[model samples]
Target: MTNTDPDIRRKAEEIIFGMWDTLTEDERKEISEHLTIEEFQKNEYIYKELEIPKCIKWLISGKVKICKSGVTGRDQILRTIVPSEIFSFRAYFANDDYLTSALSFGHSVVASVPMTIIDKLLHTNIQVCRKLIKQLAIELGKADSRTVSLTQKHIRGRLAESLITLKNSYGLEEDGYTLSIYLSREELANMSNMTTSNAIRTLSSFATDKIIAIDGRKIKLINEEELKRISENG
Candidate 1:
């Protein structure tokens, strides 16, 4: 359902404000006027694979995962989205339907503006075009790095890298050790490109080695340096 609440619109505008200094007063006003906000429950699909792009989306709160369905009917996680990050626009730029689906990792709020609006801005704003190009380049670099890690890393290294990726993406709790985001073993397996049992076994091995501590879905890094070494050696 779409939310037209003024407060939500204001919050969305505020998040986008500092992202692009090239946005003119008029462009900002236009974006604010057309923005639509929506709330999604955990595990809900924000957009399905092969769907046409209608809007450029921003994560206002909570987390989202971009994933593609593998041949074996399992989904492989591509990337995780954090608050204030823009998503779902790559397909628009490519002139194709989405290759991967986006799912809410938890209860989430998202803000969107029509792609038509962004296209108009891009045509008239050189700075906006450059900024978007830079963002695309960064995303491409990350994709390349992940591809190498998943294809070449051992089970222990893959699991350790996944944990570190989660930590870097969402950070840790106030305790400074427990990861802020809690993911089930299945989700961890998908992110690491391994079987659920393999993921669990590797995690158990890490705990036995004093590399990490696990409590249900929560994982605390016990020896972050060792974990990094394993990831680097892989």
Candidate 2:
């Protein structure tokens, strides 16, 4: 199901506006007027590679993954976004089409604020500008860290790290062990930088080791400590 409540929209806008502390009441209202909310189903593309981005999208709820296709049509998951995070800003700043595509991991809601509005706000609000700079720096750091982790870590380490990353990004279900988001094996493989068959094999190994329990798309962490140890040691 999709979210269409006016109250939710207002709350999402308010959260964004709060980040731009330098904006006046009129300015906030002006920016909010240009914002639009969109919903995407599981595996739906928010934007595709080479598409010219005209808006900055803020994930309001659910999860999305940004990915790029390799030379052989294999996907490499670059990053995952959770609620209240802004994306598609790189395209706006670069004045180019998107380098990667964003897809909803599940039913998701996002707010799209026009690039023109963002540009205007940046020019008029020093606090907003500072916040954007800080966010960019943090993103760069994360990219660097992920690059090192993906290359240096072993397959088991990579898989364990991927599981922890997913848990952090989406949280736990009501049972407190099952992952909140369910991804297909291919998606999991892409996220872990492995082939689908390899991912399946590794998952089976993890299950046999009693590190995790899998029931179709549902993954429950049975031994979080051991998982962390493997990820750290490798």
Judging by TM-score against the true structure, name the best candidate.
1
Provide the TM-score for each candidate, comma-separated.
Answer: 0.97, 0.95
Q: Judged by lDDT against the true structure, how good is candidate 1?
A: 0.92
Lowest-sum lDDT 10-residue window in model 2: 1-10
Q: In candidate 1, what are the lDDT values of residues 88-159, reduced to their tens digit?
A: 998999999999999999999999999999999999999988988998999999999999999999988888
Q: Which stretches of candidate 2 lie over 4 Å from their true place?
A: 1-4
Candidate 1, residue 4: Cα displacement in angstroms equals 3.8
Give model 2's TM-score versus the native structure.
0.95
> What is residue 180's positional error in candidate 1, in angstroms?
0.6
lDDT of 2 by residue, 1-234 (tens): 345689878878877877666789988888778878888988899999999889888998889999999898998998999999988888778788899999998888998888888898888888888888898889899999888878999989988999999988888999999998888999889988888999999999999999999999999999999999988876
| Top model number, lDDT | 1
